[model samples]
Target: MVSVLTKIFGLTNIEIAEDIVHDVLLKALESWKLKGVPENPSAWLMAAAKNKTLDFLRHKKQEEKYARQITPLLQSEYTIGHTLNNYFSENEIKDDQLRMMFVCCHDSINEESQIALILKTLCGFSVSEIAKAFLTNDSTINKRLYRAKEKLRELEIKFEIPVPSEIEKRIDQVLKALYLLFNEGYSSTEGESFIREELAAEALRLCLILSQHTAGNIPKTLALLALMYFHGARFNARIDDEGNILLLKEQNRKLWDNEMIQEGIILLNMASTGDLVSTYHIEAAIAYEHCIAKSYNDTNWKNLLNYYQVLITLTKSPVAELNSAIVISEIDGPDAALNVIFKIELADELKNYYLLPATKGDLYFRKSDMIKAKYFYDIAETLTSSPFEKKLLRKKSNMCT
Candidate 1:
């Protein structure tokens, strides 16, 4: 709704579009309280927004001259209804949201600002929510948003999908932004809850939208969706009734969503069409290994290690290396895995990364070095801000006592 309205008002008047949306929502709250939600609530809201926008344009006259472009079409009530009906049509709304996402990823804006803009505009995230997402203050987020909106005005970027030639690069940015959003939800930091399922679901929803488009339904898109589905299948099993974290080995496989797992397998198969192998493809393969395993002990550590090796070759991500070391611990011994961990050159980056110390704690615990395990777990507890993670680390630390 915001996307369609913003397109009509021009990018320069985004706040006006936002204000209209806010007012429409307020009206809905007030009216619904007395009269109850209408049968077709969506259509009702669209009509209300359309009426408010028309009234604003008419009242402002020369002030909002940008609406002058559609003034003739909106001259009569009949014509105005016809024009707005087309704009708010189901197909047009989807296209508008997709285009808006591309505009947020314009090269003129920095990636951080692009993400902030996307969270704000597309995901309907508040500045405070965005600040918490980035582990920064609201003022910092506001500044990023200010700079991003100014960049949009300066560049005059259109609210349209990129050309075919530019689709791959621009879509990569879109994927990255969505991936980060999903990760934040999957392993949320300290917030209202440990897992922000809505944020992750929103990311998955946007990815599905992209996969439906001609330029976006590529191999990489399928792979990313497959990866997401594989992870989402276990969402229910990730937490106990009390919302404590569950280790992979501890999760009940019966609680996993088999339907999502099957869908992920199908998508993973479809993602194999192109010669382009992405980190998503490798990650999906690793997740597939876990999904098919009867038990944690039955997991194909060799295959997982092979996938992680390929992933490291492609991306050289520290997280991948850390995971690869874990796989080594399962196949080889704790000593070998510990040696591999010690040899990892990017120790500086991993120093405060809770996973590293957590992995070390697990490895030491497996080796029956309880004192060392407790020490590493203590460090892991301090490094992590997540209440869920802290609880799990404390559980491990207590085992050493």
Candidate 2:
């Protein structure tokens, strides 16, 4: 609704569009209490918005730009109803939202602010919720959003889809934001729940929209979606009824969503057709290998190691190198993996990363060096803030006794 209204209002009055939507919702809350909710609630809301728009036009001051812009469309009741109906339709809503996402991810805005704006506007996320997702304070998120909105206003960016020539560059920003959102859901940094499936679900929903559009249904997008689906397939088994984290080795494969895994495979196959082999393609292939493995011991460690090598070459990310070492532990033994681990820690950015310590703990435990295992786990316990992770580290540390 905000997207549609912003489209009609010419981007200058986004705040006003949001205000009108709020007023409409408030009216619904007040009236529905006495009227006991209308049967055609959607139609009622559209009608209300239409009437509210007309009312604003009628009482507008001389310099109201939106009033002037929409006045020509409100010459009669029929035109007003038609225009509102057109905007309120399902297809229009989806298109408006897609375009709104592109606008939110405009190059003028920084990546953090772009994701922040997408959460707030397109995903109906509260400022506090977005702050929690980002592991930051509400005031910081608010300031970021304020700056992003001001930038959009200052630039007067169009509220439409990008041209074909610009789609490749523009779409990556959107994909990055969505990937971060899914990762947050898969492993929440600062929440009671280890997995916020709702956030993951929302991200998947938005990605599917991109994967279906002509400008967006490219190989990279398919690979990203495949990665999301492959992870999501195991969501049910990733946590116990008591909300305890279930390591992949311990999760019940019977509980995994086979349908989703199959869909992910189909997407992965589709992704292979294009010339580009993005990091997402490698990640998705690795995830697909895990999804197809019958058990933890049956996993193709060599295949995953190869993908991680490619990933490291492409990204040079310490995180990727750390993960690659884990696969090496499975294939080559703890000593070889530890050598790689030592090399990875030379990078300054990963000095305090808990996973490095945790990986070292696992390798020491595998080598039956309980004292060194406990030592690394102790460091890991201090490095991580997650309650689930702390508990897991304590369990590992206790094994040394």
Q: Which candidate is the best by TM-score?
A: 1
Q: Which whole-number lDDT from 0 to 100 does residue 207 have in model 2? A: 94
lDDT scores in order: 0.85, 0.85
Q: The CA-based lDDT of model 1 is what? A: 0.85
Which portions of model 1 miss their true places by more than 4 Å?
64-78, 132-136
Candidate 2 regions with alpha-carbon error over 4 angstroms:
27-63, 68-71, 74-78, 192-195
- The TM-score of candidate 2 is 0.92
Q: Which lDDT tens digits does candidate 1 get at residues 93-158?
A: 888889988888787888889878877888777789888776789999999989998987888877
lDDT of 1 at 80: 71
- Candidate 1, run of 10 with poorest lDDT: 61-70
Clash-forming residue pairs, model 1? none
